[model samples]
Target: MASDPLFERLWNGSAPMEEWTAAVSDGAITAVADGIITVHTTYFCGSVTAIRTMEGLVLIDTAKPDTAQRTLEVIRSWDDSPIHTVIFTHGHIDHTSGIAVIDAEADARGVPRPRIVAHRNVRRRMERYVASHGFNSIVQGQQFNKPGYVYPIGQRQPDEVYDETLSLTIGGERLELFHGRGETDDASFVWLPERRVLASGDFVIWVFPNAGNPRKVQRYAAEWAVALRHMEQLRPAILIPGHGPVVFGEARALQMLRDGAEALEHLVRETLALMNRGATLDAVLHAVKVPAEYLAKPYLLAKYDDPEFLVRNIYHFYAGWFDGDPAHLKPARTAEIATELARLAGGAEKLAERAAILSEQGASRLAVQLAELAGAAAPDAPRIQAIRASVLQKAIDGESSLMGKAFLSVYQRQAQERAG
Candidate 1:
């Protein structure tokens, strides 16, 4: 992990440096609220939340498959209480893959397996994951800058599925689960009314809510805002987010939730207005600017899903796949377009030379675009491949968002292979 310092930079963009250092220093299990302990992971994976109930432990979301053992150990250290229940905030791989670890632990202890609970749509999402396992693996590899990662396909089917809301009395403590469409259709937020604690799945991740993941399925931007607004009204005194640090006071929690919600609301409204005016998706993307105040908030950085992508998502939701450009509606093949551009630019060599010059001048995006054109025009050109790789590396270094860095790194690695 130390070899890739950019991961830390991108993940901890808005959070305090010392706080991040402290939280990640050995995966300490800290009490966010009374009887509620959280195991915050280092990267983008969801944090594991364990609530100490009278009967046993009630976990809200588990760590990724790779980090489950360590996270489980951290939870066990806090209390040896057998896990009585596990609630999946959503069916995202990182949050659900650890179920096997917990189930195994329960079996070894001679106790009944923990009852799993989630939104009804979780099974549908898991089925989709099963169907597109290979595609998901590839897309996540590009998204996480870890091409070698093997995403586990196995998941524990939820024992109990709820449609809208379900209040579960676990170990004599009440946990209110509300289904909300946010990052996923299977999203749920847990509210402990007695403790004034809320476990917001990916809905309240410190980063700008991931309502515009380019490769992922549909995200609920407007509905996500609505969910946040609802959570804000609940006024959780202690807010445990799916990722990043937990919020302490009700005021701070409301502020964070409201800010995130309003940001999405503003973006959605602005995008719809542009769409109503018959503006192109590209134009809408450029037109809808996130409010300066929201962008300036420490909890709402553009490190993950930026506002431009959110605008595009809104456009896609309302306007469909067509970007309103007649030429793009039935676009020519990329290679053919590149070949034409290369011909007009004199030759592939000239294009490669120009790309290299642009790369040297720090025009990384344009350099990469030109290099791609050159590579498409002449697939076997080593010079073009090298130029593309170099520019992509530069772009990766300059990128502040993890998504952008991942794409640039993957593209750069591919370019290097081609160059070789």
Candidate 2:
């Protein structure tokens, strides 16, 4: 379905933006007309930006190690600016691991290692990566499909750390850093006061905010909004994001940031209000809505992250896991429910037939629920195969968003496996 192009594209390798040109060239770097420099370090993983001043070349974030070599080559091609400082927006692997390449370049040229700076919390986050490598590998496998790829544990820790705010002058350029929590606990954004440019790492990914990754560590929705508001105050004319294309102009960038923040805040506030009133988790999830205004925004659409997940994240943030219902405290197993439902409906065959009827009548949500129950009840039944196909096709026809597309693909795979 159109709503879930990312999932479909991943499975089929036909994503619309897969070949879209990077705002920055591959294996090359360039300085913008505003004097801010940028490099598209990796296609979808990370980027590096720099600004030249009398003090030195101040870099914002680095690409992944695998991508860093090419990124450095690009940077060197653009300017011979001496690397005197590095500012890490966060401790995410893609943004920090590439420092080795930069270090090697400086050392080879007989220049001193650049001073690394980041938010104080970055140190703890890096330590957590080392402490939980196995857990992170497993989670990354699920999210990225790369199993057993051990992310490097030895991080290039920051030499300079700040708590709330820090200001510096790099090569005569004024740069200000502010701490704001978002996808990560130690997220920070850089504001260029004179050039009116902002290097927003991961905070504004051009697409939707990745605030509700189901498999990752806890994300900060409340803090994400706070960060956006802080950036809005800066009124930067040029916006260089962590991923995706760079946005030019102040008004458009601010509008995008404001809309995104408002969308997340609305979901968080509404979900929390319902939970505070003792509503069940399901009730709160269904009740929270992205305001009508943001639904049409191209950049805020549910392309990368779904809104339902965001609502669930908010619920977990405020109310914890219990749904305030005793029935779910130690609930019946899913298999138990499926077996009972199948028996009540006169076996899996009858349930499959009912699912087919419901699907034909455009009751896709109910049809899928019934089909799942029937499939689990009769794993090898021919009727189960039919029900699976019918339910998935219905979903593919009706669903929207990347999440829905992924679910449809998964169901189709299950149907094929059962048939075989």
Best candidate (score: TM-score)? 1
Model 1 C-alpha lDDT per residue in residues 91-120, reported as the tens digit of each score: 987898888999999999999999999999
Each candidate's clash count: 0, 10
Name the candidate that leads on lDDT.
1
lDDT of 2 by residue, 240-265 (tens): 77875566677777987898789888
lDDT, model 2, position 315: 82
Q: Enumerate residue pairs that collide in model 2.
A: 3-400, 3-401, 4-401, 4-402, 53-171, 53-172, 54-171, 54-172, 55-171, 56-171
Global fold similarity of model 1 (TM-score): 0.92
**Which stretches of candidate 1 lie above 4 Å from their native place?**
1-22, 359-364
User: lDDT score, residue 38, model 1?
Assistant: 89
